[model samples]
Target: MRAIFAALLGLTTGMAMAEMKTEKVEYRDGDTVLEGYYAYDDAAYKGEKRPAILIVHDWNGLDGYEERRARELAALGYAAFAVDIYGKGVRPTNNAESGAQAGKYRADIDLFRSRLNAGLEALKARPGVDPARIGAIGYCFGGGGVLELLRSGAAVKAAVTFHGSLATPRPADAANIKAKILIQHASQDPSVPLTQLGDFIKEMGDAKVDYRMIMYNLAVHPFTVPGPQYNEVADKRSWAAMKEFFLENL
Candidate 1:
């Protein structure tokens, strides 16, 4: 009986894993070939459309971290796509490379938005995705990308950023945002000063935008990232907040 029970448990676990589908998707931004990670629950996608979420990667590009997040979202019954901003095979292996690659896009918001929109288009075109109920989330550099996507007047219903930049070259463009926004930040983050948060709040307010900002005290930069800087309490709280935000808006 013990052996039989163990066999049944293994089968169940295997079946559960089989229900979730994940793949590497090759896409494009103009002539640039971008590879993104797509994941969804096959059992939930049986000829039915579901809300989708676009995930923007950090400066390191499309790596395991983003893929894990995509799978987590897929488990939550939403189709998740982790986009590539550095083009195919352009992942940065070190801080210097990451800074340069991320900085290049930061210096040119137009180029950044264009790449982001291309990812959005790819997400919309995926099977079993409801284009109208789409949302976006970003981390670090990707968090800034999500904000840019919202500012670009994309049809996304919601946007969420974790430790992303609040400064934009065109603050006046906030008037173009059509989605509700959520900003999750580390209060002690030296990279993003409190003044920047104040300015961002003013920008959103001036545009009469619907948005909310949450600050996690004692947390430094990349609090959500799993490492020495990771704050367990803040990470859990921020993720829960994001889940609620997407549920309410998307």
Candidate 2:
């Protein structure tokens, strides 16, 4: 089913663009110090506090792909922070290392949430950011992290997930969620089966959550990435959907 969905969405539009400037920013997560890349439109000058979006990376942690997404958001006139989840400049190149790092973070959900929250704080502290109007988006593992933030009752205007897992061990309080959510899923994704998808949708419905789940018939895992796994059409459409969603919600 996921494969089928990927295929269907594969025939859509092409990619879009905007130039970006990248810089490193630091923040503290309790005793641990972390760093991330801040990408914004080159057109942005000093003293311009624009709306911002936090971009979370996959299990591989901070990498060029995530940075590109941040640039894309910046091009759209939003200050985008591509956060690092695995400390400063520590990106795993292989799947094994990525899984190991992800495992350590998942083993302690509180710590994981704290790290993400710290990143959020860092973004808010930026000179041009409007602390009251922030949003988040993540890919793969980061997608799940963004959802966890929403589940934790973080005060944000919007959240978006691309090919992320939908199920969580602990259910979130419906009343606590303040952000509108948009989830893009690959219909035939083996990682998230049909049963899990149905259960997730049911839970959201029962909670009366305001959300939209877009299943791309022809896209698969890592559909939005720019590498070999990327599907140009799906990436473009999903991003368009996200841009529209954020514009309306945030």
Candidate 3:
């Protein structure tokens, strides 16, 4: 009987896993072929459109991490798209390559913005997505990506960044931005120094932007990911904060 019960449990889990649907989506951005993965709850969204969330990847570009995040959002009843910032199926495995790719885009901010806009358009065009209600979340390099989107006056309702840099080479006009912003920062993050954070907060205050900056006292860079750099407590708290922010704004 115990063995039979175990077999039943395994079967149930497998069925649950199978119910999570994922698909590869490709769209044209000018002359470039952009690619990404779309995920959602197949059972819940069968007949109705759902709120959509765009997942922007780090400097590594589109990879397993962002795809998994999309799945998590889908389980929460959202149509989530893991956006591609580095063209179709391109992922950098090492710091050297990642830096090179990131630097190339950073050197020409307009081109970078165009790529992100393309991803947003793709998400908006999806059949089951509520184009008017959209949110975006990004990590590391992608974290900065979402900020750029918000700065560009995209139609996003909410934007969240995890361990993203706060400095923008071209400062945004606060009046142009319409989205409610949530920035999750690691207090001990070496890359984004405390002084820079202070300046960012001051700039936001001066601009009169509606924003919230949460600093995890003990967290370091990449605190949310469950990899080597993850901080379990900070991750939980930040996710809870994200959920609340999305609920209120998105």
- Best-matching candidate per TM-score: 1
TM-score of each: 0.93, 0.87, 0.90
Using lDDT as the yardstick, the better of models 1 and 2 is 1
What's the CA error at residue 20 for candidate 3, in Å?
Answer: 1.7
Q: Write candidate 1's Cα lDDT for 73-174 as tens digits.
A: 999889999999999999999999999999999999999999999999999999889999999999999998999999999999998999988889999999
Q: How much is the lDDT of residue 137 in candidate 1?
A: 95
lDDT ranking, high to low: 1, 3, 2
Query: Candidate 1: how many backbone clashes?
Result: 0
TM-score of 2: 0.87
Off by over 4 Å in 2: 1-20, 42-48
Compare candidates 1 and 2 on TM-score and give the better one.
1
lDDT of each: 0.93, 0.84, 0.86
Each prediction's number of clashing residue pairs: 0, 16, 0
Clashes of 2: 16
Give the 10-residue window scoring lowest on summed lDDT in candidate 2.
10-19
Tell me the tens digit of each residue's lDDT in model 3 across 1-250.
Answer: 9999999999898667547789999987798888999998876666787889998888888888899999999888789999888888567889899999888877877888888889999999988888888999999988988888877778999989999977777775555678889999998999898787887887788778899888899899999877888999998898889889989886
- lDDT score at residue 80, model 2, on the 0-100 scale: 95
- State the lDDT of candidate 2 residue by residue for 39-100, as single tens digits: 88755544666889998889988988887888778878899998888998677989999999
Positional deviation of residue 29's Cα in model 1 after best superposition, in angstroms: 0.9
Off by over 4 Å in 1: 1-18
Candidate number with greatest lDDT:
1
